[model samples]
Target chain A: MTNKAARNLFIFGSLFFFVIFLGLTVDTMNQIDGRAPEITKDVDAGKMVWQKYDCIGCHTILGNGSYFAPDMTKIVEQKPAGYLKQFLMDPRGVNPKAAMPKLGISSQEADQLLAFLTWISKVDTNGWPPKPILAAAASVAGQPQSRGQQVYQSQGCSACHSIKGIGGTSGPDLTKVGANGKDAEWHVKHLKDPHSVNPKSAMPAYGGVPEADLKELAAYLVTLK
Target chain B: MTVKYQSQKIAQYFYTFAIVLFLVQVLVGIIAAVQFINPDIFILNFNTIRTLHINALVVWLLAGLMGATYYVVPEESETEVWSLPLAKLQFWATVAAIGAVVLGYIWMGLDPQANKTVMGTQLLNEGREYIEAPRWADALIVVSVLLFLFNMFMTMLKTKKWTGIQGVLLGGLVFLALMYLPGMFYTKNMIKDQFWWWWVIHLWVEGSWEVIAGALLAFMLMKTIGAKREVLEKWMYIEVGFVLFTGILGTGHHYYFIGTPSYWKWVGGIFSSLEPVPLLLMVWDAFRTTREARNVTNKAGLFYTVAHAIFNFVGAGLWGIIHTLPQVNQWTHGTQITTAHGHLAFYGAYVLLVISMIYVTMPAIRGVTTYNQSRAYLAFWWMTISMVFIVLTITGAGMVQVYMERLMGLDYEAVKTVYNMWFWIIRAIFGVGFLIGTAIFVYDFFKIGKEPAPALAPAEQKA
Candidate 1:
């Protein structure tokens, strides 16, 4: 082919490709717009709790937020409503050293927040965190321990410690803590006061968990291994 | 040979070294991708795969930079290289140092302690640490950089006139030298160590690189495309302006989630997001110049330059902005989204630009007017397509990973098992494309030197 003809071919090819790319981009945008779930009353209530707490200031949800706290959009799916409610009433009750301040939420507000969370849990997040074990546990019904994992994150338990191989490395890995053979009684006492077990421990103590929730959380922690 | 041609000769050597390194880098990238697909492919070691990725990227970029500096320096100086022998010696020494470092990595494995040698210093292998070369190797690299600087700066001093392109090019090399300052002090603390390391790492890739790319783009178009000097120089100035505006602050993006101060989120996101603006302007300026050129001399080289512009826009300018926003980055920071960006931006903006320079200059060195345009064009498309596929696969995988883990609360192990097959399949597809591109590139490089020259176009005929 003559040089002029070759050059023309190249130009035409580039233009054609550009047109195809534009069409694909528009189609993808349409699909994304269509798939976006509507903001219903349930989601709006959850959003209020999120806004009131300034959750986005510290935590990211679906790739949006500050990194100070764990993402909460998926929290309801991972953790139980009862456990989330209790933790909301008092974060220090879940993780004594949690950086999250107690918001002093009312029972009704907490229920609204739970409903909002449940709504968020149902949104298709497209398989993040990429762990089947966590995904499976997150979907399990009445699993308070699964909820404990969310509590572990939202309460900033992961700021210093890693759980199930995901989190910050500043503190110790929690994967082996439960499997280390500590008795339930010992965990209860330790939860009340961590310094009793190890004098040099930097871990803070929660006042105490209610007996029932404590057993479930302890059971979840033990299964981390 | 004229003094101008002497400088061209030096550039030729640098180009040959860069092309070889490019091929090696592609191979290493393929291996790393394969390992990601099947963790057991390389004995189930993340450390090994990560090492390959990091080291290959570093070497390939350094090689490209060296070649680009050699090509641009003499033209800007209006003189030949100060000492060809010294330049050659520096090239061989760098090759040796890189080889030793790679050997250490494969032999002794990746020791954080072994990787401790700061730039411009001597690396000491205190014991069995393979990754750390003998301290002399580090000192050698510094000496080599000094020789390089002396050669180029002395040439410029003799010329006594500084063009905008020259200024940006020299500014980048000087910053590269300055990057070593923080690495002088090594700490046992990983957090502190990484903080210092980023000064060298981030500064080179995001900071000096922008300057180098802008300068080289201007210089090559002026030389090859018969572009108006004034128009190209103006674009160079605007390009450098945007680079400096965003480059310094962009370092903060790496600082996020690295246990640094929380304020980096705002600083890194806002500034890094702006990094694409200059690059986008660059794309516009490149194509505009090409379209305006009254005479197109080398069709193949022009094709490469145009492709470089398009890929830079899509890969560096667009994709970079997507993840640089603070909100988006909070989730995508360490995921495969970052990997996708790295593959494209590094190869597209930097590597391809250097290769474009080689296409323009290698013929000048051989005193030829035409090359195997078909082969060169084919290789370009091969690389472009493979890179696009790789980016899509990684981005798709990252989305899936984030949803499964963050949204679904799936543990790492379960997620790993579920996504294992898809990761491997996608990576293998990318590898096939990458390998094909590399083979074509190598074949074209060898064939060009052997082919008979075609009739000279008006531009080259004038020269």
Candidate 2:
């Protein structure tokens, strides 16, 4: 084909597509604007708080921002409003070594931030920033025997293995481990020398632990199922 | 040798500064990558290192583009630059502003009280991925761009001749400035904020920048290839048209998961997939012209141009499509898949375009129109191949991440621990290879000083 004719055809075709794109953008924007949530007074203030603090710098909301902090998109559903407010007011109060710097938000600002979090929690994220398996173990919540749970937490097992939907995920989900064909003896051996059970395991051995604590931790893990 | 205008020298200065910044950027990038493997080794936090790396990249690319504009406009218009003094002023101002922004990002803490005594206000880091520069620095960028646009416009106006390439370049610059304005308007409404954020990030890369790349490539093709100006210019128009057509709406791709409405799934999926069309056309035109050239003395320039087009088509087009669909994106959004696409696409399209321009212009600026054959060829292959390896390793990591995190329903922290080997071991190896290639390319660039001048007469073309 002649170059002139071909160039013209391509140009026209691209422009035709451009018009369609423009039309779609407008339609999409219209749908968004129409369905846009009403900005409540508290939500508006919370938004101002969010921007003022630059929460996005650390925490992601709806899969944006640095991944150093947890996603705040579903924070309201994950924790109580009061807990969230208190955490915002004094982050160290909730977790002594929390990386979240104290933003020195006022009590009123904390409430507003809570309201904002509540609003965001309602927004459809299409189930993003997926939750851990421990979060879904509602059946086992608060059922841990005191000694067994204490042994589990004190030994830093939670640092690598998640339970009750909160903890490190480097190890298998202990929430279902009880049903995963492992006995107390298997757990004790694995804890003493992880490489003995699985050659490729990243888990470090805890041979220094007291046999009693290891058995208690293993007993708690067995009950997770 | 062409008479060197004072303004053309400014382009060289920009190119020099930009290359320096690029080297620094790569170093900072390696540091950021290392943090993923072992966050404890680096005193500078991941946020600080990444902010510097990303901002440095944005500034260096702009510096390259500004330099290209100064060099191209003067030559194309066939006139002396409008104001050498203003160009110099703009360059220095830009450098100072960027330095301040980067320092502010590093020294300033996110906590307001810490900054209250040190700096006047609470605002320190902007925190947005690409637009991390503080308000003052962002304003400085707008001013620098306006100054650049004015200089380019006046020079073109004085010449009283406007080529199609000049028009396209100018148009892209204007849009680049305009698109940036939306990022300055921050809001608490997450969805609204995200909608405008994509306008700046996505539009510049996908939309306006494509035109700029096309015009620049067309100019290079005309010089290196003995193609008819009309043939190349005609395709420039067509390619630019396609860029605008698809690129403007391709902003929807980013909107899909940003709490925006659901319709973006279709809007983004359809239009963004077509965003690669313009690059395809440019590739076709570049190959055709190079094949038909009377003499191809600087084979590296041609290699860079062809590689730029081909890589862009694969990186921005194919890989981008891999996640553009909402169904797939729901699984891969914010994952290494996006990171993989980002690395390849940026390297392929803008980065390669700039390097190609530099290789093409360096010889012309020195009154030579040929490459330092052995060194240039080595640099070209090293960079191209190493970059491909980097893309592959990152893509492999992202794929593994998806299977472990999404399919297996693993927690984010758990997935991170499992995937540490990929980022630390595999990605780092490829990253080093990339650095080696970049070092070789930079070394070759400096070594060009003593190389023999290109023969005035056309030589038999290399295969």
Candidate 3:
């Protein structure tokens, strides 16, 4: 093509796509109210807190930012606030091997940050960050989960521990923990107060857990080998 | 040196200063690469290190681009810079701003509280990925860009000797400056904020920057390779036309999972799939013109130019499309795959483009038809090959991550197996390689071409 013709094409194409992009951007902005959660005062503060700590530099949210740490998009769902608070206050207290360093987060800041994450969890990302294929397959297989396994997921145990490769690094891998000579009684006591068994252990006490579920969890732990 | 005016020498300061920033970028980058394998090493905050690395990269490349523009505009417009004092003011301001920003980032790292609000504003480390410069630094950056733009426009207008290259360059710069505006504001809606962030980041690299690269590359090809101006400009228009058509819309790919509509899935997929077309056409045009040229005096410059085109295709065009489609991106979006693509793509597209322009501009400004060819060629291979090795290792790590973390439901931490560790190890080794290569490049850029030993005629065309 002659330079003039190509120039015309360049001008025409750039304007056309740019206009369309602007329109789409407007439409996207319009959809934000419906797609994203309301930004309460606390939520806004939490976002600032996130920025204040430069969290995005270490974590991904909605598949954006540096991927140094875990995805924060579903953190509120994967981890309960109680555990999150403990972790935020002193990262090592929740998990000894945690990569996150304590930044002296205030009790109030923790709540606000959680609120922000709660808002993030509610955003309609159009089903982004697809479910793990193996997890999906496990559910599809329709094998009934053990009561202890249900308790584990419900309690967000995976936030701290991994059974295989599928959990946090803060806690010990329990993939073969059943091989330990400790009985269910020992396991139960350790769960209730890990410090009683190992004084330096960073694991939080599960004493608040129901006695029945604790027994089931203990029973399940012994079978992991 | 055959520099036309006193103003042109300002670019030399920018070029030299930018290489120092390049060193900073690489040094931090090596630290970051190691941190990838062992996140527990809090000796340096990975976030802050990365912030410095990427921000330095942005600053240096812009410094390089501005310098190149200042040099090229004078030659293309057939007039001197509009105001030498203004250009000098702009350069010093930019240098001061860069120094302050770098110090500000280090300060933020030492005290995370520095990023906290002071009278209701984060003073240092805005903490966004690329534009993490503090609020004050941001203002300085805007003023600097405006000054550059004003000087450029005045110079272009002084003689009114317009070429297609200058027009495209102006359009691209305006687009770049406008895209940056949205990043300065904070959107209450996180989703909307993310949407605009993509516009700034994606458009700068893929959209406007590519247009500017086209102008720079076309000018170099015409001057150094002796290509016909008419034919090169025609090809430049076509190549840029494809770039805009695909790139502007290709911003959709980033929209897929960031709280944007599902229509983006299709739009991003289709448009981005065609993004490779522009790079493809650029390489074809580059090779064709190089082949048809009557004389090629600046072999080192020509080599960098051609290398930029080819690597852009491989690193950006090929690697980008690998995971751009929604189906593939769903698994790879936040994985090391993105990291791999980012490193390679930046190096190939803009980093190499800037380096190529430097290779071309240095000899021309020095009035040397050719510089020390052997050293230049050695640096090129050292950098280009080592960069490929780094990208490949990271791509390997990314694939393993996708398998274990996404497909296999492994924990993010669990992916740090010995197998994965191997990738990081290899990557760190090559990170050092890339760093050494950069050192060679900096040396070659300044030291090798210290004096013009002799003049050489334009070599005869092979054909």
Candidate 4:
């Protein structure tokens, strides 16, 4: 083939391909365009909160973001709005080991984010981020240490402690502390004054608690394992 | 040798800067890999390191393509560059824009809300993958691209000489600029936002960029191979045809899981499977032309040119085909499989193409025709081998993830425990190899001061 003929072929081929591409693009646009779920004002505000906090930086809404955090596309269906709000309010409060840092979003902003997530849950993800299989939580609530659990709860231990993945992350996860070698005596001392055991511990002392309550709390802590 | 057009000299500067950025990208990539093992590496955390790595790679590749364009256009047009000053100005402005974006990403904290009040939108990182540049940086990118397109358009008009190769390449650039606009649009719906986002990301990587690659490949073949222009040009058109026919619609592959319609599963699966056809054609055409012109030298240039084709096909083609089917992708969509394909495909296609361009142009720009043989060979083998292992390690990781997460339905932490060893292996072993190979590649580029230019072969002389 001559150079002129080759050039002509290229032009013709490119034009033909361009036409096909244009048709496909139009078809795609038709497929996606105007099919978006209507965005309510609350959802719109919530989306800004979502972007403002850059939630997608860590979380995947519809399979597009870092894998560092769990997918949020179906979060609304997975958890209650109140649960999500509290989790968003202080992620470490619910799961101390959670990598999600507090964004300092206000209650209002959190509501907006909830709205956004509620909207997102409606979008069809084609059943992605398959439901995780987690072992049922061990039932220690009715054990002999139940009084100690009451004392633990009364003291607002959740602010700095977690048991079976339920509570704040400001301190160590106590779910396995009993098995990990924190004896009753150690728990008592640590609870009374955390600095006595670990100088760098950020947990404040519980010295003002009654001696009986402290002993009960220590016993309950040891049963966490 | 052809006369050294002033714009070509300016192109050399861009190429050098690109190499520097390429090295930076590798360093940052290693830092990110290390973070996979130990996330507490001072302020150079995973998010920061990764953002830098991704952005640097994107910008550096852009710089390389622009440089390659400036270098190739004048020679193909048979005229001096139209405005060397405009090219130089565009180069600096482009560099400054990339610099602002990179620095902004590094200094800005990972929390999207970290500096919203203090920096406003000007400096707050958006945290979008590959589009993390702040609003100001986005503006700079648009401006720089516009300047680049204007300069190239004016150069062509002034020269009044255009080949089929130039037409395709310049057209690709115009498309590139146009596609980038969609990324700036804001939508309240996350799914809708992601839909438009792929217009910029997928379209650039798989669509218009392939045209650019086709044009560049055609130009390079015309220079190095003694084969008749008609045959190569015809093959170039056919390859472009495949690229367009497959790539534009192949974007549906990404739409499969991103809240798009269910029909996309069929559309994406069918079209993306064909995306590799053109790459395979390029592989055949490049090697056939090289074999036909057996007397040509510049083995380093020839090596990279041919290797790019093979790697691109394997990484972007075969690996891509493996998961392009919705059945496979349903399990692998966001897992390490995507990462594996990403690392291989990007390296195989875009990264290697830029490196190939550097190999082809650097020696010529320096008034030599070839690299130091042993070092270039070491660089090539090391990079090629390490890249293969990197792909394997990540693919392994992805496979394990798919099994534990999708099949077993384990939670994220449970899957992490199963895959931690693979991540460690990738970070410690393969990451180091990739870094060393990249280092050698950069070192080889500058290791030619004492080498002398050899006489052109009859084939090369005709070019």
Candidate 4: misplaced stretches above 4 Å?
A1-37, A79-94, A101-107, A129-225, B1-4, B110-114, B117-123, B449-463
Stretches of candidate 1 exceeding 4 Å from the true structure: A1-225, B1-3, B43-46, B110-136, B454-463
TM-scores of the models, in the given order?
0.67, 0.81, 0.95, 0.82
Tell me the tens digit of each residue's lDDT in model 1 across A181-207: 887677767767777996545456664
Candidate 1 overall lDDT versus native: 0.63
Docking class for candidate 3: medium
Q: Candidate 4 — which pairs collide?
A: none
lDDT of 4 by residue, B308-348 (tens): 88888898899899988987887787776777888889898
What ranking of all candidate models by DockQ puts the best one first? 3, 4, 2, 1
User: Model 3 chain B, poorest ten-residue lDDT window?
Assistant: B454-463
lDDT of 1 at B236: 73
Task: Report the TM-score of candidate 4, chain A only.
Answer: 0.52
DockQ of 4: 0.25
CA shift at B241, candidate 4, in angstroms?
Answer: 0.9
lDDT of 2 by residue, B1-463 (tens): 3336646867878988888888888887787677667654576666667777777888889899889899989888988899999999999998888777766776654434333311322355665678867666778889999999999999999977877778778888998899899898657566777777887898889977887998898888876665687888888877887787777777777877776676777878888888877778888887888778765766677778788888878888888888888778887877677778888898888888888888777776766545556777776677778778878877887787677655654455555655546655666676677777778877876766467755545345341
Clashing pairs in 2: A134-A165, A135-A165
DockQ of 1: 0.04
lDDT by residue (tens digit), candidate 3, A1-225: 678888999999799999999899889888878888678999999888888888988898998889778889988877556778878888877676777788778899989999999999999988977878887787678778999988887787887788866676767888999998988999999989988998766567889999899999999999999
In angstroms, the error of model 2 at B241 is 1.2
True contacts kept of each: 0.04, 0.28, 0.80, 0.36
| Leading candidate by DockQ | 3
lDDT of 4 at B239: 84
Error in Å for residue A195 of model 2: 35
Total clashes for model 1: 22
